[model samples]
Each structure stands twice: as C-alpha cells, then as structure tokens.
Target: MSSSSVRGVSATPVESIIEPLRECMVSMGSGHGKETGDRRSPERTVLGRVASIMEVFNGGQQVLSLGDLSDRTGLPKSTLHRLADQLCQVGWLERDPGGYRVGMRLFELGSLAVEGHRLQETAFPYLQALAAKTGMSAQLGILDRTEVVYLERIVVGPVRLPTRRGGRQPAYCTALGKAMAAFDGEAMRAVVSSPMPRRTANTITESFALWTELDQIRKVGIALDRSEAYEELVCVAAPIRDSGRAIGAVSVTGPAGRMRWRMATEAVHSTAAAIWNASFRFGSAGARM
Candidate 1:
C-alpha cells in the first residue's frame, strides 16, 4: 500500500484507511450498503422514533410482536430489536411470551396525570348502582378533544359491549359525548369543525343535525344514542354539571330496542346528578397527608 502526502503532511497507508471510511459511509448511508434517497432527514430523530414506537401500542392494542412493531412503525427489524431492548431496560416497554407490551412503569407515569381527577373513585359507586337499577352497562366519561374517554364502566346484563375503561369513542355520535358537548360550547364547536365520520347508518354526520341533537339534550337534560356509534347498542346519558358546564357524563347502555327509554333516561339523569354531588363532596373532603 502506498502512502500519500497532502499539504506537505504525510497521510496513512491508503489501503488501511479506505476500508474504515467505506464502512462508515455504509453505516451512515443505509446500513445496507445502499444510497439513502429520502431516509435521511433531520425530523427523523431518535426521540421521534421512540415516540413512534410508543404510539404504535395505542388504540386497545395490548401486545405486539416484533414483526407487528416493524410493520406499524415502519422501522427495520434490527432497529426495532435494538430500540425495543433499550425501551425494555428503561421500563417503557416489556417483553412477554406473547410479545411486547407497554410496561407497568409507563402505566405508573400515566397514572400521575389521571390522579389529579379522582372522578373514577367518586363515580364508581354511582355507576354500579345505575347498572344494578337499569340492568344495563353504566359508564362515566369526560370529553377529551373531540372524543369521549370512559373513566369507569359497570356491566350488569349479558349483552356484550365494546366499551372499556380508558377506551375512547367519537364525541359526535355517542351519548356521553352529546351529553357533555351539550354544555361545553368550545367542545361543540370543535366537534362541528372536525370531521364527523359515520360509524353506522344512524350516525348523525350532518353538522345541523348534530347541533339540533345537542340542543335537544340541553332542553331535556339527557342525550340518546340509538345505534349511532354501534349497530346493536343504545345509550342514554346525562352530564355532570359544574358552573354551567359539563365536567363529565354518566350513561346507561344496552342492546338496541331492549332499553326502556324513559326509565333509562330517568336513571341516567339521577345518576349524573348523584355523581356530580358525590364528586364535589369527595373533592372538598380531600385532606393533606
């Protein structure tokens, strides 16, 4: 191998230096000995990649395989393995016989945010009572952006439902959403401006229709969802109000045509008010520890 001189300085042997430089180029390029056309971008940082990996586990996804992660995140298997290992070490993810899942540490961190609102504890008894009285599933939910997030649910009857604690449903088509949005003007405006996708044939997709329904809810102090969000489910809901706005909502849900509308409406209205009063007392009763 020949040495070269540049600017009167002697360089190392060319053969010895060239191989390391080629290896570095390949590592920087594509890690596959190919030109990176569009893959190189400043926005694709390590933090962004990590966030993408975390987001792929959302929407009721309990666990995912490495291949599932790769497909959902659009990341290579080797990269996923490396990042997954690091995430598992940091308690952001866990490895199981099934595959990978969001770890307990992540749940602990998320609980910090939820702890500020102790609605679940306050509303659980009322939800249980409502379910027992109505022979239907009862739920407590709050408006989050343009969706309703269920904080608690109590099931009674044999009718299977899709709802679960921490699950989300579109605010425009669900009874809980309508009950809350009826009082929150900002939430209603957000729903009006946002896209209202039809989940079933009965969903009220038109802005005017939704506005009318919300107005009706305001007048009656209850909202109804008759197979709007789901094909075979019906729900009745009322808002837990504070300062003329809804802080949360309560609902009784059951199979379509099986619910006694008047009885369900009365039950939800009382349940919502009961929950509101209990939550108020609970908050006031909090003591420093």
Candidate 2:
C-alpha cells in the first residue's frame, strides 16, 4: 500500500501513526489505561471535590476546620471556602464556631430514601406480627456500610434492648447484620475487611470464622447472635430481600434464656419470606446491594 494511503498524510509507519493518536487521546482527557491506583477520573466537575470534602468528617471527626478539610480533601483553600459556603447556605453542611459539621438537613433528606422509608412501611406489619406472636422485640434493620441501622421495631417483651429506631450496631456481632451480609457480597467483603470488635465473648472476631458463619447463614436463610452484641441478649434474624437481593433483615431479640434457636429461627425465617414476597419493589436499593 502507498505510504500516503496507509498513513493518511505522511510516510510514517502505521505503528508511529497510532502512537501519536494514543498520545492525543491521553492529552484530551481520555483514559490512560494506567495502573489502578494511578487511573483517577479526570476532575471535570465540582461534585467529586465536594464529596471528598464531606468524606473527611467521619464518626470520630464530626467537625473539621477549613484547614483540616483542605488537608484531607487536597483541595485548594479558596475552592474549599467557596464550596463550604455553598454547602452551608444549602443546609447540606453546618458551620460551627470553629469548624463545619454535617447538618441535620442532610440526614433528614437521607432518611427519605425509598429503600429505607418505603421498606420500613412495608415491613412494619410483619415486624409487629412477629413481635406479637413470639412476645419478643422484633426489628427491621438495614445495613449501612459495616453497621446495621434499625429502621422499624415492635416492642413486646419486658427486656430492654439497647437498639432503638435509628440506632446502629456492628454488623459482625448483630444477627440482623449477619443476615443481610450473608446475601450481599459487598456487605460480606466489608465485614471481612474491617476489624471485628468483640461486643461480647460470643462475637465472631476472626474473619475466617465469620466467613464460615456467613456461608451457613446463606444456606439456612437465618442467623443467630448468641449474646454477641450485648451480654445475655440473644437474637435470631433472617434476611429480607426484594427480587432475590437482600435489602434488609428482620430479627427477634430477647434474653438468652428465652431465645431458643429452633423456635426463633422458625418465626424469623417465615416472617422474612413473607416480607420479601409482599414488599419487593423495582426501585429499592436492597434489591441489588
């Protein structure tokens, strides 16, 4: 073939022509196909920078100064100030006397998620029925990262449980957490990656052991917390899924003396199945995660 025809304009080899095209692509905000750590997405929008700033404020650090946020987020102080001011104005973040913190408005908005609020309403009747049938405290909980957040509850028994609506407990030690984690691969990976704190002597601290238990829960469709989260507090739980994807868990809790495995599992498993059949929806998050 003629060089002009092969190379489009010059006598350059096809390989040489292709190399410059690749370089042009690299220079034009296209993917570089680099190593995973170096392949960061191009910063073309403010959403990423704003999210990075918000990620700096975690459980241990609820509030952070502009300087601290800048250091954590690696954003320029001028940009940080501008974004922070906008966030404050929009009620997404709050400016304290010395630092900024996540605003309650942000939480209120987050609570309105269809997966959470709508799921709570759909599961309430089942939770209430389980509580009445067993005379135990029943709860519906959703996994939030590595923790379980109680979304709905039915209180019946005399025992005082520590978890209230909107309360969080470690997923590795709670029956609800394990039940949800058993069916969701992401939740399982998160549990294995994090250090499992021993909430009680029975808490599964070793990753391998926890993995084995999760496997069993997946097969049986139920999980038991035998005095794991709190001393003498036993729980039996089963996962509630939407279209075969676990969105949350249903659990019954009581003192260890009364929370027998055969009895509690039977109740929780059936109730969870009923919830899945009746409340499964197309747009909820738990349907996939």
Candidate 3:
C-alpha cells in the first residue's frame, strides 16, 4: 500500500508539494526567487533529488523503505539513508516499522495556503446547498497548472468517483478546470500551450477544439464535462470569481444515466454565483467581482 493509504492521509496536489520546496530552494540557492527563472546549481540538483524521493510517496504507494526509495529514486542505499535520515530529523519524512512515510510537517505547512483555505471556507455552504438541491456530488476546485486540485467535495448519495479532496484531475478534461480556465487568460494559455493527455475516449485533447470550447464557456459562464474526465460521469461547472478574477470553480457531478444535466447546470451556476457574491461580501480587502 502507498504510505498515504496506510496512514489514511488525504491527497495533496503536486503544486502544493512543490511550493514549499521552491521557497526553500530559492532562499538557499538564489538571492532572488524569480518564479519563472530556472536554477540548475549543485544545490538545485540536491533539491531535485529530494523532490524525486518525495514525489514517489503518492496515493498509489505511500510508505517506502530505504531499499524501496532507492529503487524508486535510483539513488544508492548509502545516499538514500543519509538523505532520508536528514529528512526524518527535519520532520519532512517519518520512519515507521514498515518504512518511511510523508510527515505531518507537510500537512502543517499545507494548512498555511491562504487561497485554498479561503476558497474552502467561502464555498462550503454553497457546496452543501448544491448537493442538497441536486442530490449528486458538488465539488470546489482550483486550477493548479494543467490540473484542477479538488479542495472540497459534497456527496449526497452513495456515488463512487476517482477524485477525492486534494486529488487532481486534468484541467483540459474536467468541467471544474474548464470553467476556471475560461475566465483566466493565463490559465487558458498554460492549458493549451501543451498537448492535453487523453484520459477517456471522449476527452478533448485537441488544443484548437479545447480553445473553441473554452470560448463558449466564457460566453455562457458554465462548462460541461460530458464524461470527459471520467467515463460515464458527467459534470457541470461554473467559475467562482474573486474580485473579477477566476480563483476557483464549483461543480456538480453525477453518472450520465441519472443526472438531469440542464437542471444541474442551473444549480451549479446559481451556487457558484452565491459563493462569488459571498466571497466579495465576506473576504478580506473588501473586493467584489
């Protein structure tokens, strides 16, 4: 079992995992941290190696041994031992009777993400309303590069989905991702700049077609998943804007056979608008969109 599963750990997005490391690397290596700049010094190499080891401990496989990490990271046992021990001492990694797992330090650090916390808090009541009204699943998601990181989920009935809180799904394929990207120029550019991977047969991998769909989403203020992100699952999402910028999205999801997509869209859009309005009214700085 992945160490995360063994410890019943929640999912963590890749961006969140890398953010702290980026700060640490910038502070330790570069005098100025340019978000776009690439630093390839010896220290960066070490950080890269550390990232490699850390990346291996995901939902699929959470706990690992010195041997397992060495095999996964392609580092020598001696090197792995020294590095893992150092990480353990700093509480970034923990050693167990079975092996090494991600430490609570990561959770503590992740809790400090302001945007995520704000979205979760601001969107929760609306999410609950969406679930109660739609009798499906409602989720809050944020764009993290080419993926949407699920921040909160509300499931009314017993429905199984591949995604969970903090789990990621390709932005190019999900309604939540498309909705967020449609309102953000930078998000649109980043998503279409690269080839979208095929998740399902119905997934839109063509950049041109995706661009067209995004344009429609921008005009309509909603997006359809149409079983793109997962087979047989449909979703309708609307952008949740903060101060006129797309900070995240809210979505309702269900199996295609049972959901009334049109009705769901209305509920999703209304809920998103409610959240957006609430955010402006309650958020710090007193900004509105």
lDDT of each: 0.74, 0.74, 0.75
Which ten contiguous residues of candidate 3 have the minimum total lDDT? 1-10
Q: Could you give candidate 3's per-residue lDDT for residues 205-277 as a string of tens digits?
A: 8889999999999888999998887889999999876435576789989899978888998998888878877
Tell me, by lDDT, which candidate is best: 3
Query: Positional deviation of 177 in candidate 3, in angstroms?
Result: 0.3
Q: Which portions of model 3 show Cα errors greater than 4 Å? A: 1-112, 284-289
Of the candidates numbered 1 and 2, which has the greater lDDT value?
Answer: 1
Model 2 bad stretches (over 4 Å): 1-112, 281-286
lDDT of 1 by residue, 12-58 (tens): 22222233434444445433222357454421555446666776776
Q: Cα deviation in Å at residue 89, candidate 3?
A: 23
Candidate rank order under lDDT = 3, 1, 2
Compared with the true structure, what per-residue lDDT tens digits does model 2 show for residues 136-243?
899999877688888988887577778899888889999999998888787798987789888778888999999999999888888989898899988999988644
**lDDT value, residue 97 of candidate 2:** 86
